[model samples]
Structure formats: C-alpha cells, structure tokens
Target: MAPQSNRVVELRIPSELGYEKIAREAVATVAHRLNFTKEKVEDIKTAISEACTNAIRYGSGSDARMKVVVILTADEDKLDILIKDPGASGAPPIDIDIPDIDGMVEGKRRLGGMGLYIIRELVDEAGFVEAADDDEGNQFRMVIYRVEDTKTESSPEASASGADNGGSP
Candidate 1:
C-alpha cells in the first residue's frame, strides 16, 4: 500500500565486473530515499545482486562485452525491479530447480537457483519472463510488498483459490 509517494532509478550497466557495484549503489540510494528498514534494504540489494549476476553470467556476445539494464522503483509501501539480460551464451535451457516454495535449507544453498529462491522468500510477488526473440534477452521482474504483520494471515481470495471451494482442485 504505497502512499502514492516513492522514488525510482534506472541504471545501465555494461557486462563487466563493476555491474555489481552499480546495482549495490542503486539499491542503497533507493533504500535511503524510501526510508526502508535495514532488513528491507538488505533484501532489495541481495535480490539485485542475484539479478545482475544472472545477467552478466548469461547475457553477452562472443566478444564477452554486453550490457545489462537494471530498473529500481520504490515507494513507501513497495519495491519493484525489472532486469533484462540477453541470456547465458551457449547455454541450454534448464528448468529452474527450486525446493518447494515454503521450504528453506539453512546454510547449504548453491548459487545457481538460489537467487530466485531468495527473491521469492524475501519479496511478496516475484516473476520472470524470457523475452521473445524480438524483445530483450531475458526480462525478469520482481515485486516486494511491504508488510506490517508479525503474524501471517491468509487472504480470503487466496484461500478460496487453493480450496475446492464448491468445485474441484
């Protein structure tokens, strides 16, 4: 529930080691502007790191020089991210293998699929799309909803969607 007040920043990072720094800076600045809690800032930056890492590791030309685009938008109640990457070179399409959405493993996480997992855990709504041949490489979008609740409560609509309700699963 953003109060119709927020800040947004867009940065273009070339496929280089310094891309991570750009992402880090973007998160830091936006967090400061939004007055995000320390934990929220950490979550945002971490998610940004995963996104940039994927783009750099995957999107690039044979020349090993490419570009990554990162967009960060934050408000009093939400944070939205859009990341675009050409895609991993010479890489096969691999289904992202993640543990059940509600599961987590303490300190034994691998880097590959961990990004999406972490993003899901930290954010309220997260989604990714591989853009068409006509669009950018891989376009991923993640949204984090602000929370004021210490106890998790299910929305009626959400609960209904999961139940047979008056029909079937």
Candidate 2:
C-alpha cells in the first residue's frame, strides 16, 4: 500500500499491447486531477505508453500472464509515476549514456533509442528503480515537478467529470 497522499491511482493489467491504453488512461486521469496542464498530461501519457510498450514487448516478451502495474502519486508540488513490469527476470543494470539531441536531430545519430531520451526531456526527472520488495521485476520511475499557479483553473469538462471532487483509485 502507498502512503496517504493528495491523490494516488494504481492500475494493473496484463502485459500485452491490448492493455496499454488502460495504463495511459489511468496516468492521464491522475495527472489531470492533480491540475496538470493538458500538454504535460499528454507528455506523461506518451512517455508511459513507450515505457509500457517496452515492458510488454521486451521485458515480458508479450506474455499475457505477466502483470504491469502503474502507480501514480501526486502532491501539491510534484507527481511521481512508477511503472513496474514483473517479467521473467529482473532487468540488468541500466546505464543511460546521455544521448546528444542535436546529433540525433541532425540525422547524425540513429533515431531508435529515443524513448528514454524523450521521457527525460518530458519530465523533470526519470529513472529506473528497484522493483517492489517481494517482486522480482523492473520499475521505471518518472517525476514531474509542478509549478505554483494561482490562476490554474480546471476545464469545464474535467469539472463535469468530477475531477475537482478529489476521487481515488
């Protein structure tokens, strides 16, 4: 169980392409409720989609039985997202050598390894972390810091959907 916070949403689903939307939707919902801007929420959604795709296609080998769990935590100043994939085995240590965005944009470097790069660019901080204590798995943690905005206002659609009512999942 996660510590009590302003908002927390947890989602678990099979490790398959068919379930990616669930993860994205859950993240988006939590982010929206946390008062994130639409663009930031979309960025979180895209990054999460890539991470989950890698987890399903590579980590779990597309196994439908394996589970992918996503936990979204939000406070007044930050939103932390953890995406866990309990694949066949734990992932080897990851050493992310910083990629040169300029070179990649200029076609000097290949465009294949942009998932993590894009994630890093999108969020304030992002990294892989140890999985749950009892679970042999890999976890990707992404953090986004929220800037204080006194004028921040919820859209009518979000208000109509009860986002301002402080729901939990």
Best by TM-score: 2
- Candidate 2, after superposition: displacement of residue 9 in Å? 1.0
Q: Per-candidate TM vs. native?
A: 0.66, 0.71
RMSD of 1: 7.8
Query: Model 2 TM-score?
Result: 0.71
In model 1, which residue pairs have backbone atoms overlapping below 3 Å? 58-87, 58-88
Cα lDDT of model 2 by residue, 3-113, tens digit:
246687788889889798898888887777777789989988987887777777666778998888888888877888887876554453354434667888999977665
In candidate 1, residue 90 scores what lDDT? Answer: 38
Candidate 1 C-alpha lDDT tens digits along 70-150: 888877676778777665553323333444434434445432456555554454455565566687466667666566342
Task: Report, for every candidate in turn, its global Cα lDDT versus the true structure.
Answer: 0.60, 0.68
Give the best candidate by lDDT.
2
